[model samples]
Target: MTVDAVEEPFRTQLTVRLRQGDTLLGVPLPGPCTFTSGNGIDILWMGPDEYLVLGLELSRESSDLEAELSRESSVLAVVDVSAQRNVYRLTGVHAADVLAHGCAIDLEVAPVGTCVQTLLARTGIVLMVREDGFTVLVRQSFSDYFRAWLADASLEYVS
Candidate 1:
């Protein structure tokens, strides 16, 4: 009998929030789809009233993401989402196809350089465009199940 081993990919999540201020480290924040960059982070404008700060791997011990901004005398609230999410980067030629099985939104129309928060297989998900693939963010509790589902959906391409 032959033993089969399945190799899964690696993933990580980073939750980012910013302080309400006139500027972020001398760089002014713009309206709509604008972004501000500094301190190894990219602040993305998600909506008229919402923003998402993207950064490197954050430390689990640092529960307060707004501490730095707070110290800078900016009005901001700390958002603790350490246990709320998981992030995965999906590559390969079949990346879009794998997502098609779960996501209702058309990837072709989504276009690259855009970020969308939608549902996948009835679960909430955030999709980000990349040069060669896409990044998917989902709640932590559903990560394992989502990964398994993704593997099954990708079987056609893997074979």
Candidate 2:
């Protein structure tokens, strides 16, 4: 199993627009090029004042999460974009190399907890560096193509 790519669907995904230094939501908004994980959720910094909140718990409903986040006065907007993207877990030692085949970012120096929004295989994606592996978030429309590309890119390392 050289870079296993498994789709993780139905996870709660919220696009949050908040002020840069607001900590009212309890979840720390990570800075550029980083993510903060805790309480079964990961907050990925998408832009200077925007973040993608991913609920690590697969069973959680996006509506419930969205409602909860919406109550925060500091949050400018809480959009439930759960269905807009599909989560893919890419594991194993060759995972980074496989991603590098299409991504321009140098993954070698990206420490765990690093997250960045970029193009992978020409598909826009949000990649989070994790201890076990890497978590890839790709738009649903491009999921199939990205999956095929990942498989093909990792073919040489399967043996």
Candidate 3:
């Protein structure tokens, strides 16, 4: 199995109540329980009125997004969490099985573009289902252990 810590394009997380006709950086906010992408930016629906934005970490664009969303409401919040987590790209024929060892989520039935917040080895993580693999996002503090666990869990399949 191949498990590598790879750099993501960029991420901007936000918490706010998005309403009809609301747009962030000209991209229409994805409604509840869905995801939307525009211009290479993907917005993951994490919770009601909550989304995690992924794209290139362009400083100027970041500023523009923030400035525009700030007016959404007084409770609207745009936070840059690009550095808060370590993302591991786990790929191989056995990668999904390896994740199932710890994750209770049924990846076998999940769509390719789905993202689920779940636990792996008792650590909170975000698992993004890809066509051939998964993108696992864990907090920086837990990255080392998470990565090690992945290595051990997939040894049988890899070897």
Candidate 4:
């Protein structure tokens, strides 16, 4: 198949709930339907007061990150949700087409930093649009199902 799926398991993920106008990782939290990346971390806006911080190859443990984040005065909760979800990357020319089969959003029009919580193949996922492809975050329990569904969805593009 032209579309390739790869799983990136067990990277640090933090759920931070903070007061208005708070900042993390030296960058302000993104606005609705958007995400920001800096200092080896990507911060995605999850709600009015919540953001999902994705760490990339950070030298610290999830707990360490949590403790550091919790130190902020405006921070209300800093949870290490690393074990709660699995990440998948879909790439290749047909990637978006494969996603279109199950996702309702028009990801092609969405900017590279766009991120949204939605359902794909009836499974809840946090989808991030990227220049290379797309990143899909699904609950750990539903990862297998989502992978299988992704495989099935890309079948037609195989020739």
Candidate 5:
């Protein structure tokens, strides 16, 4: 018997930490820019005074984006977190059901296009739900385990 391997598309994640009173890329973000990933990237408000920037593609310099922000003020600290985390997308009708198994947040009330940083099976995960699917961000060290768990949870709907 011959079996075909399932191919999953990869999504890149870039995380940048912005300090308080610092503007991103010289662009003054008055108040926490809601739903604005800053430069069309996936950004999240990690704390009252902190923001986590994510993106699918990165520039050659690595610090290109951060440098732009630094031009405005010297108070912001931008750090590249590409090597520290893994990003995944989960979609389909059963997406919510699968997430409900391990996620602590209430998906029903979270609404679409909204992002939430929460725990999944004791591990920290950032979840963003859209109309088609949900994007999940997890630590690189736990990616393998997390993927395995996600696959297992998605078994029921794959076929």
Candidate 6:
């Protein structure tokens, strides 16, 4: 297995809660249990009216989004909590199998471009399936445990 911690860009995560009919930071809203991207941003839908906005080097974009959201009458809340979570990426042939050891999601059959909030090593996580692997996000407090568990889960496949 090939697992590496991703050096995230200057984080500017903006959690946006919509009041109604509001798109996310000018990007189209994602469907249920879906993710949508525009420009360099990816919006992960957390609920009917909530989303998490993420991207690389998104400082300026974050500010613009925050201000834009403030002007929208339909916006419920826009809060930045960029430092609250840590992200890691695991890619390679055995990546999914390793994650499956602790992740409840069926990565073996999940389609590409899928993202779901699930548990990894009993830790809350967001798992994003890409073309060849998965991106895992864990809350700050559990990041260390998540990483350790990932290392152990990957031992069978790692050389």
**Backbone clash numbers for all candidates listed:** 0, 0, 0, 0, 1, 0
Over the stretch 22-81, how does candidate 1's per-residue lDDT look in tens digits?
555454554553455566555555665456655545431343444554454553444545
Misplaced by over 4 Å in model 5 are: 1-34, 58-61
TM value for model 1: 0.70
Residue range 49-147, candidate 4, lDDT tens digits: 999998876556787778878888888888889989999888889999999999999977988999999999889999999889999999999988998
Model 1 CA deviation exceeding 4 Å by range:
1-39, 58-65, 71-75
TM-score versus the correct structure, for each prediction: 0.70, 0.92, 0.77, 0.93, 0.75, 0.87
Candidate 3, run of 10 with poorest lDDT: 1-10
| Colliding pairs, model 5 | 25-69
Q: Model-by-model lDDT, in order?
A: 0.60, 0.85, 0.69, 0.87, 0.61, 0.76
- Superposed on all Cα atoms, the candidates' RMSDs to the truth, in angstroms, are 5.5, 1.5, 3.2, 1.4, 4.9, 2.1
CA-RMSD of model 4: 1.4
Question: What is the Cα-based TM-score of model 3?
Answer: 0.77
- Stretches of candidate 2 off by over 4 Å are none
lDDT of 2 by residue, 87-117 (tens): 9898898998999999998999999999988
Question: Model 4's lDDT to the true fold?
Answer: 0.87
lDDT per residue for candidate 6 within 121-153, as digits (tens), equals 789887777775777778989877877887788
lDDT of 1 at 109: 74
Model 5, position 45: C-alpha lDDT score: 58
